[model samples]
Target: MTLEARLAALAAAGQTITYGKLARDLGLRMEELTNALERLMEEDAAAGRPFRAAVLRQRLSPEGLPAPGFFLKAAILGRPAQDPLAFTRAERHALLPFPNIPG
Candidate 1:
């Protein structure tokens, strides 16, 4: 399945995936995955959809959150994530019609 499809499924199931695992699953390098995620973020934003990439997390994330770069990319895309937790929470909530994931 595509990255977005995978993410959508995970989000619908109230689950999250680590960046490393996702990269390995897609047979992509870390950099490539990050690049793809950033592009996805931009596309989602432009389409007025929540970031499907929000279902991604860092391996050692403190709150099951994505790496700091996720926020940085969001900022670059004109969505400044001053509060990372809050931002990610909202994104995940809006990503799917029925969001079962908690912040």
Candidate 2:
């Protein structure tokens, strides 16, 4: 499956994945994953969809939040993210209403 489809499935299931594991599963370098996610974020923004890339967290992220690059991409896409945790939570929630989950 494509990365977007995979991410959408994870979002629908209210699940999150670490960036490292996702990268390995997709046979991608970290940079490649980040670039792809940024493009996805841009498309999501244009399409008025929730940021599916928000489901990608850092391995060491205690709250299951995506890496800083996610936020940067969001900002570049004209999404204001003054609060990273809330922003990601809301995006994930939009995809699937798991309000208590962080990812």
Candidate 3:
């Protein structure tokens, strides 16, 4: 399957993946994978669509402590959208820090 198809399939299967794992699976160097992902993001942005890949973050520790550093839990293609505000809200939320989270 093509790289994008493989990524979509993994997402459909509800499998969480990271850049390292994806690179290994696709037989690409880490830099190559990064470039590919960036290209996808750029294309989506240019098309005025939601990012093709979603980045999920999670605490490193079970106690939800921030000391261990956050990690990328998943990267998946976004679903078709009928509402543009949904994407705007998500982007706004991500860029603007909330009161609870430290900047």
Candidate 4:
């Protein structure tokens, strides 16, 4: 089966997956997975760093946090569509689905 297929099956089972699981499920060694991930990352480097969950910080605590915790969304950089408040008026207008709009 494909890697994505395995990943989807795991996701449907309500289970979280790690690189190790992905590698094992796809009949790949950890090093192979690592190499593939590295190649993907390298390709994305020209378009800003790829967002790897393993590399990105999902949440962070304040410097003086003594309470339960604090959190913020991990950054999704690179693409213009991914950026909020980062478009021209025409660009925003173009995103409207006028054909699907009801009177």
Candidate 5:
């Protein structure tokens, strides 16, 4: 399946997939999958999609150290990652429909 299709599928499934999982799903390398994500994000913006690029951070436990499953706690459409807590729920909602995001 195409990268767009892959991301759309995950969103439809309401899954919080990791990079390795995404790579496995597409039968691509980690770097390639990461690139696809970037491309999808660009396409999302170019298509005038309101959803911006962001990472999904679902806490594994109620407490303890951060998990290593995801790349970062939070990130936006631009560079320089930021913590998810800094973003409001509404802002995160704005990024919900973008590539590789679950509904």
Candidate 6:
């Protein structure tokens, strides 16, 4: 499947997916997935849309260690919605570095 198709499929599933898992599922290297995501983000920005790829780190467990891993989900911005799993402000700042994006 094409990268766009894979992204659409994940968005349709409405679930966040770890990079490692997504890479394996897509038969792509981890770096390939990351590069694709970066390209997608750039495309979205150039089109005057809020980035659709939300990259977030998994939450920690009671032991204060992450339970799963870093993940990304496709989302529509500028809409009335809630992502309980959305990354914290600090996390977004740390993960994304788009100059045109507002926090």
Can you give the TM-score per candidate against the true fold? 0.89, 0.88, 0.50, 0.36, 0.52, 0.51
Residue 55 CA error for candidate 5 (Å)?
Answer: 6.8
List candidate 2 stretches off by more than 4 Å.
97-103
Top-lDDT structure, candidate number: 2
Cα RMSD for predicted model 2: 3.4
**1-103 in candidate 2: lDDT tens per residue?**
7788789789889899999888888898988988898888888999998899999898898998999888888888899799999998889889885656675
Q: What residue pairs clash in candidate 3, if any at all?
A: none
Stretches of candidate 4 above 4 Å error?
1-16, 52-103
Write the residue-wise lDDT of candidate 4 on 25-102 in tens digits.
Answer: 778996776556554434444555322312211124222111111011222223333332232222223323352354
TM-score for candidate 4, residues paired by index: 0.36
Of 1 and 3, which scores higher on lDDT? 1
**In model 4, where is the ten-residue run with the lowest total lDDT?**
64-73
Q: Write the per-residue lDDT of candidate 6 for residues 39-68, one digit (tens) a residue.
A: 776676467654445432233333222112
- What local distance difference test score does each model get? 0.86, 0.88, 0.46, 0.37, 0.46, 0.47
Q: What tens-digit string does per-residue lDDT give for candidate 5 at 1-103?
A: 8766655554444444545555677799967766666666566556755322233333453322223322231234442235433332333345445535553
Q: What is the lDDT of residue 75 in candidate 2?
A: 88
Model 3 scores a C-alpha lDDT of 0.46
Each candidate's number of clashing pairs is 0, 0, 0, 0, 0, 0
Looking at model 3, residue 61 earns an lDDT score of 30
- Report per-prediction Cα RMSD to one decimal: 2.6, 3.4, 11.8, 11.4, 6.5, 10.6
Residue-level lDDT of model 3, residues 1-103, one tens digit each, is 5567765564445343565666778898967766676676667656764443443212243332211111121122343334433542353344332423654
Instruction: State which candidate, 2 or 4, has the greater lDDT.
Output: 2
Locate the minimum summed-lDDT window of 10 residues in model 3: 65-74
Residue pairs with clashing backbones, model 5:
none
| Alpha-carbon deviation at 19 in model 6, angstroms | 0.2
TM-score of 6: 0.51
